[model samples]
Target: MKKSKISLETSFWAGQEVENPFEFLEVFFEYANLDYYKETLNHFLLHTNKLEAYEAGTPGQTFIIYTAFRSFLKACFSLKTKDKKLKVRKAPEKWSILGQASLTSEEYQNPFLVFQKAFDEKTPDEFDFFLCEITHLSLSPFAEEFEYDFITPFIHLTKMLDAAKIISERGIKKNKE
Candidate 1:
C-alpha cells in the first residue's frame, strides 16, 4: 500500500491527541480564574464564523476572522507567562477589538461596532473585580515577590493542536455543507 502524505492540518490536530483538550483545560484552569481556555474557544468560534462568511462570497468577513486570529495569538502568549492568573491580564482589552475592526473596516465596515456598543452599556461588576484580582495575583510573580514553575512548551503545543483540530473540523463541515 502506498503511504499517504500527512497534511499540515492533520499534523496539527494529531498533536492534540484528537481530543477536545481546550474543554479539559477549561475545567482545569477554572481554579486559576484566567478563563484562558474559554477565551481560546471564543476566538475559535469567531474565526470559524468569519471563514464561513468569506467562503459564502463575503470576503469582507476576513476582518473578524483576522481579529480572532490575533486574539488567539495574544492568548497563546499569555499562556506562556509563569503566573497562570496573570494570563488573564495579558488578554487583549476590548479596545483591541475596535482597533482590529478599524483596520479592516475600510473594506468590511466595522462589524465590531455592535460589540463595542454592547460593552459600553455594561457596568463592571463583582465578577470583573474578581477576575482582576486573579490577574493581579498571577502577575505578582513578576514583582520579585513570588515564583512559579515554568510551563513546558509541550503543553502549549498540545493545546494549540486541540484548538486547530476543532477549527479544521468546523471548516471541513462547513465546506461539505
Candidate 2:
C-alpha cells in the first residue's frame, strides 16, 4: 500500500497535520503576515474561480451568493480591534458598464477605480482568453478560508447584478410600451 504525501502549504496555512514538521515557521510567518502577500492570497483564493450555480442564474441562489461575499469580505478585512468593516456598497449606476465588479477588482486592485484604469490600459483583445478562462463555471470551490470558499461569492454577485440590470431594462421597455 502507498501512502499519500501531506500538503505542505495547506498544513502550514490551514494548520492541518503534516508528515514532516516545518522547522522555520517563524521565518514563514514573517512573509505570510505581510499585506502584499495577504492581498495576493486574497486575489487568487477569494476572487478567481466562477461557480456553476451562480452562472445558471437559478432562483434563490442570489441571496446565498451575496451572503458568501459579505461573509468573505467581513472575515478577511474586518478589524476586530477598532471594529472597522469593509463596506461592500452597491456599485453606483455609472460603473455598470465596466465588465462587472466580480472580474476586475480581484486582479488589479481592491478599489474599483484602480481596477478600471488597469483594465483599460489593456485592450479587450488582450484579455479575451483570460476572460474566457474566468467564465468557465465549475462546481468545486476554489479555496476555503474562515470556513467557506471565497471566490464563488463574488462570481455570484456579478451574475446577480447582471440579472438585475436585465430585469430593470425589461421593466422600462414594458412601461414605454
Candidate 3:
C-alpha cells in the first residue's frame, strides 16, 4: 500500500471571497475537533464584547472599540504565526490596518455609522473587512503554505453586536430592581 501525505497548505479563495471574516470560525468548528481552541476563542470574544456596550452615539466609543479590535486581531495573527515570530511592519502605511487614520470629526461623533452599515447588510464591519484585507496582503508571500481558508482573519461584527444586546437586557433588569 502507498502512503499519501496531506499538505497543510490551503486554497479555497474564489474571486468573490466571502465578506464574513468569522466564517473561518464556523469552518474551524466544523472541521476541527479541538474543543479547547473553540472555548478559548469563545471566551475571548465574550470578554472583549463585555468591555464596550454599544450606545448609538457616544464619544470615545470608537477608541475603545478600535483598541479591542486591534488586540483581538493581533492575538489571532499570533496564533497563525505561532512558529515564526511576528513583527510589526516598519511601514504600517504600506499594508497594515494599524495605519488606518483616525476617524474624522463626524465619524468621531458617530462611529456607529460603520457598524450600522455592516449590520444592515449582515456582514462584517469595516474593521473586520480591513483586517481580512491586510491579512491576505501580508500573508501573500507565504501563500503556498498560508492557511487562508481556515484562518479567515476578522472576528465577526455580528458577534459583537449580538453581545451588545446583553447590555440592554441588563439595563432592563437593573431598572426593575
Candidate 4:
C-alpha cells in the first residue's frame, strides 16, 4: 500500500509554542529516523542520497528541511550553562548551520560522533558533556532526564529502539483507522 506523505512540520512547530518543547520529543524521534538525521552523522551518511533523491539535482528542499530540523533542535537543545542547570538560550526560528555544523562529504562507518571528537586536551568530563550535546538527551540525574536507562546503558538503548518501534506501530495503527 502507498503511504500518505504527511508533513507534520507546521503542527510540530505549533506544539512547541504551547507545550514544553521536549514533550513532543517522542514524535520527533519518529521522524528522526534513518532518513531524518541530516545534522552531523546523518548529514554526511545521507548527503549523497538526499541530493540524488532530488530530481532537480540541486539543494532545493534540502535547505528548507535542514532549517526546520535545526530550528526545532536549536529551540530544544540550545542550552547555556547557568550555575548548575542548563537553560534554553536560543529559540531561533531558523538555525544557522554554517561552519563545522554544515555537512560536507567526499567518503565514511558506524562513525561515532562523540568518540571521533576525542582529542588530547579534552577531559573525560568533556566526553560526557559532548555525548549529551550530540544526543541532545541529557544523562544528568537531576536534570529530570527521561527514564531511558534501567540497569545499564544497553537497557536504555534497547528501550529507545523499542520506543521507535512502537511509534511505527502506532502510525500504522492510526493509518488503518
Candidate 5:
C-alpha cells in the first residue's frame, strides 16, 4: 500500500514529539503485530487509546485513531468483500465508513460524519449502517488499493464505542460525585 507522507514539523502533537501519525500507525497495521492482541484492530486501538490517555487532545491521536478506524474498516472489508450479499467491494478503499456527516467538530469528509451519526445513535445500527453506507456511496478515486494517512472524527467514535463496551465488560463504573 502506498502511504501518504507529512513533514515532522507538520505532524507533531501539542508539547509531544511523535513521529508522523501515519508512520506510527504503519508500525502496527503494516510492520508488525503483537501476540496478545489476537486481532490487528484490537492491538492498534489499544495503543491509540493509551496515547490518547497520554495527552487528552492532540494531533497525534488523530492520526493514530484515523489509522485504527481505517484498519478496522479494512478488516471489515476483507471479510465482506467476497460476500455478494454485502457488496463491500463496491465501497471506497480509503473512506469506507457508512454515512455522510454534513457537519462535524473536527476534520472529516463524507463518511466520517456518517459514522458519528450512527455511533451517536447509541444503538446497534453502527455496523448495519456501515454495510448499507458502503454499497450506497460513489466509488472512490482508487479502484483497487490506497493507503490513507489522516485522522477524522470517525476515529473518536470508535474509541467511544470501545470504552462503552469495556466499561460494561470490565465492570467499570463511575463513582457519584
Candidate 6:
C-alpha cells in the first residue's frame, strides 16, 4: 500500500514545548480506527495532481477537500476514551462531587474550543482536519495517560497511512516521467 507524504509542521504555544501535532493526530486516529477517514485521505492523495489541476479552474474542489477533511476531523473528535482508571498521586486533595462535575465539564468544553481555534487556522495544504482533531485530543485532561498506554500501537497504524499517502502522491509524479 502507498502512503501519504504530507508533512505537518509543529508549533509551540505560550513558550512551552509541544509535541509534534502530526504524531499526536496519527495516534488518535489510529486508536479510534477511523477507517473511513483514512480511506478518504488516501483517495484525495491518489488524485492530488488532478485535484490540484482543478484548484484554479474549479473552486468546488477546494470545498470538496475542505468538507471531506472537516468530516474526517469530526470523526476523530467523537472518539471516546476507553480507559477509566484513575491514577494515584501523592498528596492529593479531596474534592466535592460538584467540583468533580465542574472539572469534567470544563475539561470537555475547553479542549473543544481550543481545537476549533486550531482547526480554523490550519492551512489545507499543510495540515488536515484530522490532525487538528488529534491536537484537541492531546490537550484533553487525560491525554498523557492515553499516550502512555496506546501511543505505540497508534504509531504503527499512522505510519502505514502516512506511507500510503506519500506513495500515492509519488506515484502521480512518477506517471509524468
lDDT of 3 by residue, 1-177 (tens): 994422212223121222222333233233333333334334333333243332324424333333334433322332222213222212222433322223333322233332333345432334455544433333232223332332222233333332222211222111121
TM-score of each: 0.21, 0.19, 0.21, 0.27, 0.22, 0.23
Write one digit per residue (lDDT tens) for candidate 2, span 18-124: 23312222223332433333333334332335332323444233333322233222222211111122212334445444534234433212232322332344332
> Evaluated with lDDT, which candidate comes out highest?
6
Separate clash counts for every candidate: 0, 0, 0, 0, 2, 9
- What are the lDDT scores of the predictions, listed in order? 0.29, 0.31, 0.32, 0.30, 0.31, 0.33
Pairs clashing within candidate 6: 2-164, 3-163, 3-164, 3-165, 3-166, 4-164, 4-165, 4-166, 5-166
Off by over 4 Å in 6: 1-40, 47-58, 80-177
**RMSD for each of the candidates:** 20.4, 20.5, 21.3, 19.7, 19.3, 20.5
Q: Please, what are the lDDT tens digits per residue for candidate 1 over residues 1-177?
A: 995422212122223221232332332333222234445334333333231221234433433333333333333332332122211111133334432322232212322222223224332232233233323333232322323222222233233433333322222111121
Question: lDDT tens digits, residues 5-34, model 6?
Answer: 322221211122223333334433443334
Q: How does residue 6 of candidate 1 score in lDDT?
A: 20
Name the 10 consecutive residues with the lowest summed lDDT in model 6.
79-88
Better of 5 and 6 by TM-score: 6
Clashes of 4: 0
Which residue pairs in candidate 2 collide? none
The reply for model 2, stretches above 4 Å from the true place, is: 1-145, 172-177
Of 2 and 3, the candidate ranking higher by lDDT? 3
Q: Model 3, residue 154: displacement in angstroms?
A: 5.4
State model 5's lDDT: 0.31
lDDT tens digits, residue span 55-135, model 4? 234344444444344333332221111103322222234534331121212101111121222222343334333334323
